[model samples]
Target: MKNIRNFCIIAHIDHGKSTLADRLLHFTGTISDRELQEQTLDDMDLERERGITIKSHAIQMDYTVNGEKYVLNLIDTPGHVDFSYEVSRSIAACEGALLIVDATQGIQAQTISNLYLALEQDLEIIPILNKMDLDSAMAEEVTDQIVELIGCNPEDVIPASGKTGMGVEEILQAVIDRIPAPKGDPEAPLQAMIFDSVFNSFRGIIAYFRIKHGTIRKGDEVKFVNTGKKYHADEIGTLKLTMTPKKVLSAGDVGYIISGIKQAKEVKVGDTITLVSRPCQDVVKGFEDVKPMVFAGIYPVDTDEFEELRGSLEKLQLNDASLVYEPESSMALGFGFRCGFLGMLHMEIVQERLEREFDMTVITTVPNVGYRAMTTKGELLVVNNPSDLPDPSTLASVEEPFIKAQIITKSDFVGQVMTLCINKRGVLTNQVYLTADRVELSFEIPLGEIVFDFYDKLKTISKGYASFDYHPIGYKESKLVKLDIMLNGDQVDALSALIHRDNAYELGKRICLKLRELIPRQQFEIAIQAGIGTKIIARETVRALRKDVTAKCYGGDISRKRKLLEKQKKGKKRMRQVGNVEVPQEAFLAVLQLD
Candidate 1:
């Protein structure tokens, strides 16, 4: 136990965390040359294609130093702001963390936020300067930045290149020398904190946990303190490239346990696991529950497939505990679920994963942020959907969620970046120059403004040099309006959005135009109107597909043709009253893609 070291890697997106992890695994000989692949820790194909780590991955490695063997448990975490919950959970189960900074990019917004999370957990932080092999690497400047940020000595930061495996030996040596081993009494009651879990069709649900006290053995009856569910520890093992069965796993070790638990809700991530024979006195205080930043409805393409969709979500929730959902029915979309996600990126990844992993075709509604509405009687209501908003005539003001956003970029793009934020109704709170050429700008912005296209636009205007990170500050009263899109005088609740009053008209105009292009022509004309409180802000029409009754009488008398045309017009007017518009899936998607 004294020779065991548990640590995780945390960094900004594309800061070489996974690459560094790949090098570590290879140098430790945990994986052979034949099995080694780029971004080996990212198992999902979506992760590989996007070059991002969507989930936190845990693995164990064996090392020999000074003629003594040591066991190291390492968790590789995602870097995006949306998956910060994953980072927090990973930090909860570790004794130390490797704060990796890109040599070429210096310190980023996400890198700083993740470091704070680790600091809050009181985990020992070891700073490492990665990407040393690149020609653009600014090792000296970046090393200084790391020292100033973490308050560590210049000598404490190790310079390494994940691509060439530089300083691999030194990193491994630091883990054993600096990171303390797990502290617990083996004779104490069995206590463990499940940090992550996955679903297995053949073996049932597999939960990965870090033992906090005592030992767990195969066939032992373990009980989850949170859910109060009991299960037999059918199999226990450490996570290498694959699961290696062990008869027993004691305190300080990270391992997986399978109990043939089929129900996804039975095994909850962050729950305490203790033996039924000798349960622990206190529950494990893991990370807090995930706070979702964006809400949207996900409905099956076919109404009857609702049950199948629920099953898929349950299984998916087991894998991704950050996902929060509840059953909801819509007038236009039929039955579906309103799921809360960490951000737009997280929402997109979940939608894509459902389609690819579970073969569930779904339509996602317009994403929005949760709001607090106070009624005339002083009753506060949580509005997760625009349709849930009370009448505008209600006697109280509405409060919108706001966030403190930190953006780091070069000085050249500062003007453009500031303009973009101000246009989003963000108020500049602070500005500091970390270096002469690099600046860190802080703004208190409404969460709703950044939910849709803020991230995409920031990347564009800064030419991909800016990194943005934000956390909720609290609720602030704002003049907001619920923008509803109507089709043929009927409200399409699924396409509605609660937006700031100042920008509502511009946004409504954009949506109306975009929908006009997306919705196909019907038998009769379709009116696409965006309205707020019965006042139409914008409108567009999709002309009907005209079938000329006069086409067959081109050479006939003009009076006869006019009579026939008038008859066709009357029939078209009647058809318009009864015809129904079939909104294609692409139109719903286009609303989300509106610029």
Candidate 2:
């Protein structure tokens, strides 16, 4: 156990955590020069294309120093705020963390968030200033900032260049010396924590776990403490670049367990794994179920593909335990699934995966945060969809989720950023100066205010120098009303949204203008209107495509032309009365993108 070191890398997005992981893998001789790949731990194509780590990955490496062999377990984690839970889980499975700060970018929002999480887990932190080869690198200033933020000695900081592989060996040596080895009694009762799992078509559910005590071997009968389901361990393996079969994994070892459990719902992340024959007295603590923050309705473009979409979502959910979905039907969009996500990015990724991986085109409704509705009968209900909101007469009060947000930015754009936040219904809580030119701003804002384009606007106002992170605080009382869009006097439920009463006029007007530009002209005029309850706040009309009624009558009598025009006008009036405007898919998406 003394020769075993387990650690993870935590950093801000685009701060080179994956690159450093690749360098460690190469320096340790875990992979050959020809076998090495860029962002090797980022196994998803979406992650590689976006230049971010969306999932956490673990691998075992063997290294030697002065003829002394040591085993290193490295877990690479995502840096985005949406995946902070994943990062926390990874940190829990390790004894130490390498906090990587870019020499050029210094510290960002997620960097601070991850640091606090590591501190909460009581893990040893090794600060590393990366990207030293860049000409703009400010290693000294970043080092000072790290000292001020974390309050560690100056000599403890390590300078490394992930691109050039400089100081890689020193970092590895530091991991072995500074990160304590995992300690547990191998003779104790079998107990393990499943940090992650994946579904296998042939082998059933493959659970990735860390053995906290006792031993696990092939053919051992294991039971999940939460679900109370038992299955025999078909195989036990250590994860290198791939799974390498092993006969046994003792305490302090991290590996995968292939249990002959076919159903993905039976295996869950953060669940305890114990021997069925020698069951432990108490289940491991610190396991909490993940609840999604944003909700949206997803429907296939072709209604007949509902089953295919359902199957695709199920398969995707097996890998992503945070995703939740249930069947839903919409008046505008037919049969579909109302899905929940960790955030906007998670929602986009799931939609893209369904289209790119499953080859099914889907239409997604506007994303919304859950609302709390108190009925007249004193019943509290949680509403996820705008269409599901009860009538005003049936409700006593309505509450919306709010978040405590932190923004780190340069002082030059402080005023502009503050204005932007205030416009989003954010109330300033506090402010602190990290340096002469850097400031941290805190605000309590409604989650619905920033769910769509707040981040994009913040970047635009700060000129890409601002970083933001937020967490749900709780629900707050607000005068919110459901805004429904009506086309040709018919309500479109898919286009309904809940908004604060104060901003209804402006938001409704903007959505109406965008819809007018997106909807194509038809034979009869289409009246697009935005309304709150029975009152209309904004309206736009898509003019009909007119045809010359007397185009073929050359030198005809004036009376003939007049009669033709009158007849055409009457026909158009009748058509407008009974015609149903067919709204294009683009119009629905455009309304969601309204600024």
Candidate 3:
């Protein structure tokens, strides 16, 4: 077991972390060529569709070099900043990290951010330069950048093309040579950290953990260090990483332990697991609970599908604890869920999964940031839903979440990127040229401002050369106003906001155009208006919706026709119960899209 090693692949979005994991999985004979799906660890439908890993996935592999068998526990972590906590928790389970750098896009902002986290964790870092197969690949330059960034020998960098399996053998050898073997006493009291979990209604809670010391086995009574709840382990299984199961796992092994635990809350991602017989006094520091940054209300298109939607959420939560939802009743839209997510991308992935995986149609509200309201009545309110906001007259103070954004990009687009950040009310805090061709720009900007299309804008401004990584920098008191849209004379709660003074007009205009695009031709002329205070700043007329309802129904397709009407009625049910006009699902997302 001295040769055994565990490591995680870390990178930024589209930096090819999952692709690399897939290549390793194939190279180690973990998955056969015919059975392999691209980015196999991204098993979730949402992950595949979005081309991003929302959750951390782990698999074990057995590799032989010079006739010596070594077990490598490979974990693929989320690269998006929204899932930063999850990434940290995943990295905690490993002793080292395969820091993958895009050869063509060397040392991105997120790459540096993730590397910093790994360094703080004291994990041995093995740099791997990927994307050598690309036509514009800069393998040697990227290796040089990695050497400078990490202060490691340039030749130590393992240049691999995960796409074509080039240099994969070299990477495997480097992992065995450079990554440290797990260090802990197997004879001591059993101690482990529950880094992740998946709850199956049939198998109960499956907790994946890394044993820090001692041994845990089938039928051993275990206690949760934090909660003090005890359970008898029913079964112990190790991932062969070859897409199958092994009988048991011992110290330094990464695998799942099932104890017939039903609830997910029982064994959190960061909870400490220890033997009840000989408990250890030392408590391991677990990752903090993920606080959702972006929120949106998700409603089924058909009201009758409410139960189905809830069931889908329950199923998704089995694999993803980060996906949170609570019952939300809308005045226009019927029963829906106030879903919490790490960011906009997280929310979109869940929404897409619900539709594709469960075949359920859903209408989602515009994504918004959680607000901390200091009311005139001396009440501190943390509002996740716009519907929960107090009336304007009752408010005394309002503040929103902000982020410290770090951008690392080419020098040519410094001015363009700076202007974009400034337009979003970003205050430049620091600036430095990382290299002759690269500049690192730091700013304090509203988290909400950067959540929507900021990544795309950064890429646009930098001509696809810039990268950004931001983390929450706490809330700040700002000159803020809630812009409300009145459909007729009544406020449309869904179309409300907390906006900065200078941005209200532009935001309102954007919302109006979005409304025009979302609101199909209705039976009656609808007035779309965006207002700041009592003044309407932007207005657009949505002509009566045309071609919405089909006049004819074929006799052979009565079931389909009835299903369609039922869906329409269900949609109408979810729409707030205003006096007369019914708002469509598209109206909620209109202001969210730029094009």
Candidate 4:
């Protein structure tokens, strides 16, 4: 145990955490030169293409220094705010973290947030300033900021360039010396924390865990503390890029246990695992299920594929415990699933993965935040969809979820960013100048206000120099109403949304206009109206394509042409009264894109 070091790399997005992990893998000779790939730990193609880590990966490596063999377990974590919960769980399973910060970009919102998460776990943090090879690298300034903000020793800061492998050896040596070895009693009753899990077709659910107090071996009967389901460990292995079977995993070690549990829902992340025969008297602390922050409806473009979509989500959810979904039906879109996500990025990734990995084409409705509704009977309910909201007469008050957002940007664009935030109904809580040219601003904003396009606008206003991170601050009272879109007097629940009452009219008008532009003209005129409850707030008309009814009567008398036109007009009026508007799928997507 003295020679074993368990740690993870934490950083802001695009801060070279993956590159650093790759460098360590190469320097330690854990992977052959011929097999070495850039960002080897990032398994997903989407992650590599986007130059970001979406999933947390764990790998075990062996390094020999001064004739002393050491076992190093490195967990590489995602840096986006959307994956903060995953990061926290990864950190909890480690003893130390390498806090990587870009020398040029310095500290970002996610950087600070992740640093605090590491601190909260009481883990050793080694401040590493990466990208020293770049000409614009401000190593000295970034080092000072780390020391001041993180309160770490100035001399202990390590400067390295991931691209050039500079200081790679020194960083590895620091890990052996600085990060403490995991301490656990191997003789104690078995207790392990399942930090992550993956499903396999042949092997069933493989649970990735950190043994906190005891040893686990093949054929051992283990019980999940939360679910109370018992299973015999079919196999035991260590993750060395790929799974390597092992007979036993001692205490203070990180590894995987494969139980023949066919169902993925049986094994959950952040659940405690113990030997069923010799169960631990108490389970490990700090295990909490991830709660989704954003909600949206996912439906198949072809209604017949609903079952296929359901199966795909189930398989995806097996790997991603953070994903939450339940069956839902739409008046216009038919049967679908109402899904919950950590954030917008997570939602997008899930949709993309469903399409690419599962070969499923799905339509995602407008995302929404969970709302608290109080019925006239004094019952409080959480509504995930606008259509789920009760009638206004049956509701007493409503509250919307809010977040405390922290933004870091260049001081030159502070005014522009502030204006954008204010326009989104963000309330400024604090502002601080990090440097002469860099600033950090905090705001308490409604989650609904920023879930759509606030981040994109913030980037545009700041010229892509701004970074933002947020956490839920709970729900607050707001005058919010459900705005429904009606097509030719028929309500379309798929296009319903909850908005602040004050901006309902303008938003309704904008949505109606966007729908008007997207919905195709039919044989009969279509009336697109936005309403709050039974009252219409905004309306737009998509006129039917004009057909020359008098075209057949060439050189005819004016009275004959008039009679033909009048008959055509009467037929059009009757068609408009009974004909149903066919709203294309693109129209629903267009409404979501509306600003």
| lDDT string, candidate 4, 66-142, tens digits | 99999999999999988887898899999999999999989999999999999988999998999999999998889
The numbered model that scores best in lDDT is 1
Residue 76 Cα positional deviation in candidate 1, in Å, after optimal superposition:
0.8
Over 1-595, each residue of candidate 3 has an lDDT whose tens digit, in order, gives: 5877989999988888888888888989988989788888887766787788888988888899999999999889988877777788878898899999988888888899999989988999999988988999987778888999999998888888878988889888989998999998888888898888876768887888888888887788999998889999788777654324445456788878888886656766677888899998897776666788888889888899898898888767766668878998877678889998988777877887788777988888778888898889899999887667677788888889998989988999999999999988899999998778899999999988876788888888889888888888798887778888877556787778777878888888888777777766655566788886678999988764334444566566678777777776666545425326667766777666754
Per-residue lDDT for 1-595 in model 2, tens only? 7888889999998899999999999999999999899998888899989998988999999999999999999999999888887898898789999999999999999999999999988899999999999999988889999999899998999999999999998899899889999988888889899998887778877889998889988999999998999888889999999899999998888999987787767887888899988887776664467778889999999999999998888777767777899999999889999999989888988888888877989999888989999999999999999988888778788999999999999999999999999999999999999988999999999999888889889999899999999988999999999998999889999999999999889988998899898888988888999998889999999999999979977896999999998999899999988877877888777866765
- Sorting all predicted structures by lDDT, with the top scorer first, yields 1, 4, 2, 3
TM-score of each: 0.97, 0.95, 0.86, 0.97
* Number of the candidate with higher TM-score, 2 or 4: 4
Candidate 1 regions exceeding 4 Å error are: 551-563
lDDT of 3: 0.82
Q: lDDT (0-100) at residue 276 of candidate 2?
A: 87
Whole-model alpha-carbon lDDT for candidate 2: 0.90
lDDT of 1 by residue, 564-583 (tens): 98998898889988887888
lDDT of 4: 0.90
List the candidate 2 regions with Cα displacement exceeding 4 Å: 550-579
lDDT agreement with native, every candidate: 0.94, 0.90, 0.82, 0.90
Query: For candidate 4, what is the TM-score?
Result: 0.97
Stretches off by above 4 angstroms in model 4 are 553-570, 573-578
Which of 2 and 3 is ahead in lDDT? 2
Alpha-carbon error at 132 in model 1, in Å? 1.3
